[model samples]
Structures are given as structure tokens and as C-alpha cells.
Target: MRLPILLLTLALPLLSQGQTADDIVKRYLDKIDGSKKWKDVKSMITKGEYDYGGIVFPFTTYAKAPSQYKFVVPFNGKYYAQGYDGNSGWKIDAFKNETTPTLLNGSQARAMANEADVELEIPFINYKAKGHQIKLEGRDTLDGKQFYIITLLKSGGEKETYYFHSTTYSLYLKKSIAKNIELEKALLDT
Candidate 1:
């Protein structure tokens, strides 16, 4: 009897550990402030400036609920457009910027579809149901700030690591190796 009781005590932490990860993600979604409003928002336009290595580039992300998106990025003085229009994904010329529109299918289109989710949901929500996997990789300090390292493995086989504020649970950074995109945009208005 005493041995069984002792075992339960030891197992409690492991049980709660799984829940803590879910709690962290839920709190994060609450902190950001959206849900029903996001559902009602048929379209959203996020305007902001992206700066890298001391250079600032103005950009905008437009999204429609469920999965429609269009974003423009400036490169070498011209703007490049990319988006998924519900039916299919497309990309404009990078050199001429707007001279041509090309169809995007397969992995590239799938990536765009993932990004095109206008709700901007907390990835952990229904993650398992969607066939995705998430792992909370403990906590640590980065650049003098504390953060929780969460790794997200998408159903599509893409993997991303996200750093969230340890206390606030707000996402501070996201890195996707497959996409080769490392974005830190909390300070930017997006």
C-alpha cells in the first residue's frame, strides 16, 4: 500500500508536466487577445516594417479567414507578392516583382496554406487532432530574457521552434529550418 502511494506521488509530476505545456499554450492565446473576434474577422491587414541588419523594409500581410492570404515584401526596390487564394497558391515574379504570376503546388503551396490561416490560432490547440506534435523543451534565458522553448512538428513534416516569454507565454521568436525563415516580429506592428 505504501509503495503504491509512493508511486502515485512520483507519477503526479509527470502527469502535470503534460498539462503544463497545454496550459502554457492556452495562456499564450489568451494573452494575445483573440478568438471569437478572430472568427468574425473575415479579413485582416497587418501593416508593419521589417528591419534586418540595420535596414528597414516596409511590408504588409493581408489575410482572410479559413485560408486566404496575400503578403508583399520589398526586395531590391521592388515588391514581391505571394499568397494562397483558397483554391490555389500563387507567386509573382521576384525579379520583375509583378510581371508574372506562377502557380504554386506541392510543398510550397502547403507551406503557404499553413501560413494563410487567418485566425492565427495557438498551434497547440487541436495539435494532436490535426496530427501535429509539440514538445516543450524546458525553459532558459536568451538575451537576458527568460523563455520557454517549444518545438512544433507539423503534420506536413515541417518543424519549427518557438520561443515564448517565460512569464507571459507570449511568442517572442519563431524559426523554421525548412522554410529558412527566422522571424522576430513582436516589437513590429503586425
Candidate 2:
């Protein structure tokens, strides 16, 4: 009897340590200024410095609701532009000796389409409608700050893990399964 009682006591804390993904997502949206405000927004524009390859490149992005995105980066003297217009996407890149504007295909096109629809309010707004699955990975700590870890698994098997503030609900970080130049405007004010 003592053995069973001891085991049950230990299990109680572990059981209460986790929450359903839906519950976490709902609370997160509520904490981040609610969904009512998100409905009114149709577009967003942000300008910030991009840190990559040890060089800081300034970038500006314009996004339209549903599926449209454009990013312009001035390199050296020319502006490299990339935009996704609904079903198609294009890129104006700088080459070694020449600059070229080319259309994107396959996964690149699809990724751009997905990125184009990013809203300022958190990605989990219509998560279910988008056929994305969420899993709560409990909590973690970094630099002495605690964060709630939630993983979003996309339909195509792409996974992105989001770390949110454990108490304040602010977005702490996100790790993608692959290395891609993604525009994360809604969170970083960039």
C-alpha cells in the first residue's frame, strides 16, 4: 500500500506539468492581445537589419493578407527583390557579374506562398483550418528564463518549434527544421 501511494504521489506533479496544445494555443492568443484585433489587419510592412554571413543587410518587407509578400534588400548598390503573388513567386537576385530576375518553382514557390500569408497575430490563429498539428513539449529554460515549448508540425512533415515566455506569453524564439531565409515580421518588429 505504501509503494502504490508513493508512486501515485510522484505521478501527480508530472501529470499536471503539461497542458493540451489547444489549451496552450488558446491562452497564448488571448495573452497576445486577443483575436479580435487580428481580424482588422489586412497587411503589414516592416524594415529592419538582417544579420547573416557576418554582414548586416537592411531589408524591407511588405505583406498583403491571404497570399502576397515582397522583400527588398539593397546589396552594394542594387536592390534584390523577392515577391510571391498568389500562385507564383519571383526573385531578382545579384549574381557574380550580372543580376537576374527569375521565377521560383516547386518547394521554393510553396514556401513563399506560406510565408506570404503570415499575420501579425501569431501563426496559431487558424492552425486547425490550415491542417497543422500542434504538440506541447512542456517547458524549458535558457539563460535562466523559462519558456513553454510547442512544436507545430506542418502537413508536409515540416516542423517548427516555438518557444514562448512561460509567464508573459511573449514569443521567445523559434527553430525551423531547415535553414531557410524566412521573414518573421509579426514577432520581431523587423
Q: TM-score of predicted model 1?
A: 0.59
Best by TM-score: 2
Stretches of candidate 1 off by over 4 Å are 1-19, 33-37, 44-60, 94-119, 177-190
1-190 in candidate 1: lDDT tens per residue? 9999999999986775554566777777788664544445577777665565556666678887778888787767687678888888888756563678888878777767766766555556567888888888887788899887887898878677778887778887765432302233322323
Model 2 CA lDDT for position 163: 83
Candidate 2 lDDT: 0.72
C-alpha TM-score for every candidate: 0.59, 0.62
lDDT (C-alpha) at residue 188 in model 2? 25
List runs of model 2 lying over 4 Å from the truth. Answer: 1-18, 45-60, 72-80, 95-100, 103-121, 177-190
Question: 1-190, model 2: which lDDT tens digit per residue?
Answer: 9999999999987775666777777878888767788888888887766555446677777988777888787888777778898878888766334366578888767767766765665568888887889999888997899888899997667677888776677777776532224443223213
Clashing pairs in 2: none
